[model samples]
Target: MYFGKKNSEEPEIIMEDTIVYACGSADCNGWMRKDFASENYDCPMCGSQLVEEVRELPKIENEYNAFK
Candidate 1:
């Protein structure tokens, strides 16, 4: 059984596949997830380097910059 949220009841089960990755930077507590088929996968909160390996989010000066 899946651990995360499930899709609504439907004739066909559409499981949304995602890849969770940790930030490549240090001293940051951020996490990110990207579509399994996506080519670009970066931290949503902070534009930091991300790798397939589990890591910690790098410390960022400003988190709002990402929104701008």
Candidate 2:
């Protein structure tokens, strides 16, 4: 799990089960993952170029039933 920097002005909400994939390239430490929406994200770690590679990842469901 990764902890983002906090802002004192806003309420703090903990995020769980946020899965992010690191770049397969050994030299590049870029990472890609879905955001709140199920859209493909580019590199969020190193801002490196991204390629569309189909991956079989576990389905993520909202435990709070927010989508339902």
- Highest lDDT: give the candidate number: 1
Pairing residues by index, what is the TM-score of model 2? 0.34
Q: lDDT tens string, model 2, 1-68?
A: 98998877874555555455555556786655443323444455565555544445555555555755
TM-score against native, each model: 0.35, 0.34
lDDT of 2 at 25: 57
Report the lDDT tens digits of candidate 1 across residue range 21-40: 66677866566543231455
Best by TM-score: 1
> How many clashes does each candidate structure show, in the order listed?
0, 0
Q: Which stretches of candidate 2 lie over 4 Å from their true place?
A: 1-26, 34-42, 62-68
lDDT minimum window of 10 residues, candidate 2: 33-42
lDDT of 2: 0.53
> Residue 68's C-alpha lDDT in candidate 2?
50
